[model samples]
Target: MYTPPAFREDDTAVLHALMRAARLCNFVTATAEGLMATPLPLFLDEGEGEFGTLYGHLARANRQWQAPVLGEAMAIFMGPDAYVTPSWYAAKREHGKVVPTWNYVVVQASGPVEFFDDPARLREVVTRLTDLHERPRVEAWAVSDAPEAFVAAQLRGIVGLRMPVTRLMGKRKMSQNRSAEDRAGVAAGLRQGERASDHVVAELVAEEGAS
Candidate 1:
């Protein structure tokens, strides 16, 4: 991530919070064949490793996990993002020098990629993942909800992933490079928009105390 000093997020807690809030992530790995990527809903065990461990699963037949990884894997977690038009900037009117840009938060985690197939480990991973996403629903689902034989059979069709984070890079670009007046204009413009994501970027701008 090419993050300028103004947009860099070095706080570990904040970075972890952003990662946790991201429900889905893209797992990428370099292979002899080429770059392989998969979108998955991953959960983080913040207590697991030095920098926390990521857990997820993919279908057993998915060749991504089977590929020989030449280096550490990468997990990209994206938070709220929005398009920022120059029309929203005060500078655009003041100097007519403004251009379009994007404002967002993202975290990239890199670590050795490990795949597991043991039923017990896969079962634990699946159970934890299920609980994370289903906890918000009124009627939460559980791994044991299915028949023993059926659940066991289903588990055989997927592989478990564990990537202990060795490096974490976080970027938060919310008009930090803009002047105070321009930032305020952007925030006001986002607040008026109907997209919920724009509102999120506004909140982030506020949290950063940028303006």
Candidate 2:
């Protein structure tokens, strides 16, 4: 991530918040063959280590888990993002020097990757993941809702992952580099757009500008 000082985010709390809010993450690892990546939903255990420990699972047949990692594995989490048009910049009218850019929030966690096939560990991971995502629903489901035999069989088809985070990098580019007037224009323009994510970015831009 080539982040300028204005866009760089180094606060651990903010970075962890972004990771928790992200719906999914891209898990990447460098291998002797090449680079392999998988889209996964991972949980962070904040109290487990200095940074945190990441937990997730991958399909047993996914070759990504079999590859030998070169050094460290990376998990990329993305937050709200939106396109910013030149028309939203006050500088465009001043001297026609404005260009289009994007506003987004992202975080990357890197650490040694470990894969396991222990049934007990897999069961715990599955239960925790299920509970985390289902908590907000009216009729929340749980691993115990399914028959033990069936759940055991299902767990056999997957492998568990654990990565104790050794490094964390975060970036939040919400028109922070723009002048106040230009940022206000961007917030206004995005708030009028149709996408829900655009509206989120708009609010973030407005909040940052106000600060």
Candidate 3:
């Protein structure tokens, strides 16, 4: 969250797009006991508030939900990330002054957290979540695909969460601080990596360098 001006992303639309693209986020809250966190797949209601509202669910057994939050809760969304070796930096060849680094994109949303257990509300949240993920699959699944009694019983084991985002912080560190030549080398190096995320990061690096 400590972002330099070169990496800061303050555009609301860009921040929301990055948030939407992230399939999962770390939901964290400060409690009297300690910091509690959960990895959750949350949906964003972009029109809900000034910064949009986040919706998700937590397991009924997850103690994080039961803990009293001392302050605003936070959701950390991670986007494309990759390791950048100094070997990829032109500066390394020009003068051995380069060091290894990492390039990544992240968005952190924080606000008051609301937990609910009403069956109807939980049902709606579950359905919306299911539809959002399933929409990309060929054979999409639905909550109605299961038995009514079974679905009802499953919903009982979880709780719904709502967070009207009050603050949004976004950072896009795609080798933006590097020289154009160094950044190009980074993009080339990432494109050669085996991980799919590496390829994604490559495109971002190339775009940043071009800009």
Candidate 4:
């Protein structure tokens, strides 16, 4: 994350919020064989340690869990992102010096990785994860909704993951480096776009402008 001072996000609260907003994350680890990455849904427990702790699970047969990791594992959480066209920059018309860039928010957490197979702990992790994602639904489901035997069998097919986060890096590139007029143009352009994600980024850009 090569972040300039204007784009760096160091607020712990903001970083945690971004992590929670990211529904999925890319978990990466350096291994003797090579680097391995997995797309996973991770839950962060902010009260666990100085930074926080991450919890997730991987399929029992997934070789990533078996690989020997070096130092710390990284989880990349990407938030709303959009392509910014040069046409959206006022500087493009003024000096024709502006180039296209991207507007996005992301957070990366690094920590020692631990894999466990304890059934009790696995059950608790699964329940917490399920509750986190399901709480907003009208008919929220729970691990207790399923039969004990079935849930137990399902748990057996996966291994638990825990990473006590040691470092957190956050970046929010929302046209903060651009002039006010250029940023306003970007927000207007993105808000009028068809993609829902672009609209989201537009809101973020607008918020940055307000700040």
Worst 10 residues of 2 by lDDT: 44-53
lDDT of 2 by residue, 1-211 (tens): 7989999999988999999999699999999989999999999999988889999999999999998899999999999999999998999999999889999999999999999999999999999999999999999999999999999999999999999999999999999899999999999999999999999999999999889
lDDT, model 1: 0.91
lDDT of 2 at 83: 97
Candidate 4 residue spans exceeding 4 A from truth: none
Write down the lDDT of every candidate, Cα atoms only.
0.91, 0.96, 0.95, 0.95
Give RMSD (Å) of candidate 4 vs. truth.
0.8
Model 1: worst 10 consecutive residues (lDDT sum): 202-211
Using TM-score as the measure, name the better of candidate 2 and candidate 4: 2
In candidate 2, position 143 carries an lDDT of 99
Worst 10 residues of 4 by lDDT: 91-100
Q: Using alpha carbons, what is the TM-score of model 4?
A: 0.98
- lDDT tens digits, residue span 15-98, model 1: 899999998999999999999999999999999887899999999999999999998999999999988889988788888987
Residue pairs with backbone overlap in model 1: none
The digit string of per-residue lDDT tens for model 3 on 44-127 reads: 999999999999899999999999999899999999899999999889999999899999999999999999999999999999
For 1-211, candidate 4 gives per-residue lDDT tens digits of 7989999999998999999999799999999999999999999999999889999999999999999999899999999999999998889889998788988899999999999999999998999999999999999999999999999999999999999999999999999989899999999999999989999999989988898
Q: How should the candidates be ordered by lDDT, best one leading?
A: 2, 3, 4, 1
What count of clashes does model 2 give?
0
* lDDT: the better of candidates 2 and 4: 2
- Cα displacement (Å) at residue 20, model 1: 0.9
